[model samples]
Target: MTVATFDTAVIGGGLVGCWTALFLARRGARVAILEKGSVGAQSSGTNFGNLRLQGRFPGQYPLSLRSQAIWEQLQDFVGSACEYERTGHLYCAFDEGEAEKLEGYAKVSESYGLSIERLGREDLKHRYPWLADKVTAATFSARDATANPRLVTPAVARAARDAGASVFENIRVSEVRKSGSGFELRADPDLRIHCANVVNAAGAWAVEIAEQFGETAPLFAAGPPQFVTEPFPYFMSPSVQTIDGSVIVRQTRRGNLILAGYPRTAADPASQRVPVPPQKTLAAMKRLAELAPVLRSCSVIRVWSGTEGYLPDMVPVIGASETTPGLWHAFGFCGHGFQIGPGVGLCLSEMILDGGTETPLEPFGIGRFRSGVAVSEKFRREFDERKTA
Candidate 1:
């Protein structure tokens, strides 16, 4: 087959990849996307749709806020329904340490001009009767939102295609190498992609593929095996589980409750692994009951799981690689990529096209780590010190 070329080749067609492609294409840059499966068929579509801006590390706080702005007006540009909803998020504090952390975050978030209201348990109970007593404190981010990922991402790809960007679905990249003044991508089952820059937004598989180009930055899987429940009324609230928690039960605009959460079991190493069993379901159900007592009546009609990568510092690496000069990273979201994907994708595209991002993408660079190794020890030590305070 003839080698397909573009000014830029985006390696993954998930939301991040599609957003990156469309954003760049809109700027008149030729863009192409290669997907290992149908567009937005993997983690981008599988996970819960939380356009949240709560409880994120202060460093990522600003990026998420910017993404929320894009999500607010995305449908206007897409010319179709993306199903953005004002399903406010209530980030709770189950312990004093958590409360302190929440308090600290709330103070700084205001400086970003985000309207996050902190509430005591009593105040929470008065406003919403759904919460359990286990919640000691909570912060409400009214700016937060949720969207049907199933709709938003595909629309992005469609828009990109409409704007002259080409997308290849189910064409897996087998190998990558620097070629001429650009790069060459070998796709399995057939096809080769040669372009000036290659983007790795392969969702769960990003780390594995990035390493083939010599990026060994210790990005491991994070998020639990998740599943969704049948449709229900507007309840459950668009909330998140913290203190390393999961069980992201949110009511869809279609009235179905999306049941999903993190589990302790790890996925197998061979491929994008996710195993769901009876025991796992039962344990998650129990946790769900504590968070929302009404969930006792809601039976778990289905279950699913997906793998997501985690950098040791709990941040993503974006921009030109130290070893692979033309390569740029857009992975390791630590399960929170969906909310900030638009901002990230836009920043990456800018970095590729303009040589540097106007937005603050420095905290997320690979250089933050110690020569390709993670700063997990520093992250843990700081986390512990915060707990004692």
Candidate 2:
């Protein structure tokens, strides 16, 4: 077997792993990315592409804002726009209870120095005349944006390769064990990878790797159902969603409205299959129409979903391993990994190279799961009780 050496080995080629490799390679590290399949072909590529900042977990504001900064400069960093746009994000409220939730979310965002605009029913009608009368209140954040999920990971991987990082696709890592002061990764087709540090950003399949080091998390596989309508007139700009976690929709410049909703469907990582239930499609369609009456007639041209790791607490596991040195984990992001992917990568690179990052990652530490995990309300509301894996 041929053995390749690197300063850091990133296991997974999704946005988080690819961006980690890119930043590490840029810092003059010998980096290699081992992916089971093509980069971004899974969850990273199939996401709804909402780079939202509003309504994030309070502890995640710093990281989310940092990630948005990178998204704003993606073209210069990765040499592609990836269809990124700061078209803003509008979170609507259907009832007074939902409106209060929006207000609390806006306050949380404001504390992080993010500008949030609260809009009443008349304000929503004036700005988004297409919205239905039931949308009683809303909040808008210009900082929230969108991008092409399908294009980002590949572009970042190319940049990583350009910066002297080796990217090995279609390579499934079968075993990873600590070797002396470094680690050794054994993969299919008879290849060995040795590295001083290892980052397991393996998305849905990351828990298996973490368990190898005596670390465990209540990670499950699930994905939001996504649908896209046939091209129509381009009018809707901002990404819009309901505060009650019903549906989210955004229109492409090409006039197709992309829609996604909660009560995410369960996924199977072993089979590499993520099936979007027919009932979810119908329910999301109804919610979208209720949110915006004008889009009721829009025909859905396609529907899809992908496997994503979700923790019971609805938080991602990041930072160094609790039991193993030089090993880091960044996975189980639920379905919100796309927007914060870049920032997480950058932070990982800093931790690997510069010793630590300024970002507050203590909340996402793997040690939190040591004493059993608590299920979050958001998790309960966003996912079906039976569908979770």
> Best candidate per lDDT, number?
2
Tens-digit per-residue lDDT, 123-235, candidate 1: 97888688778888888888788888788889989999988899899888888889998898888776887888888887657777767866656766534556667666775
> Candidate 2: where are CA atoms >4 Å away?
382-384, 387-389
Tens digits of lDDT, candidate 2, 105-170: 999999999999999988888899999999999999998899999999999999999999999999
Estimate the TM-score for candidate 1: 0.89
TM-score to native of every candidate shown = 0.89, 0.98
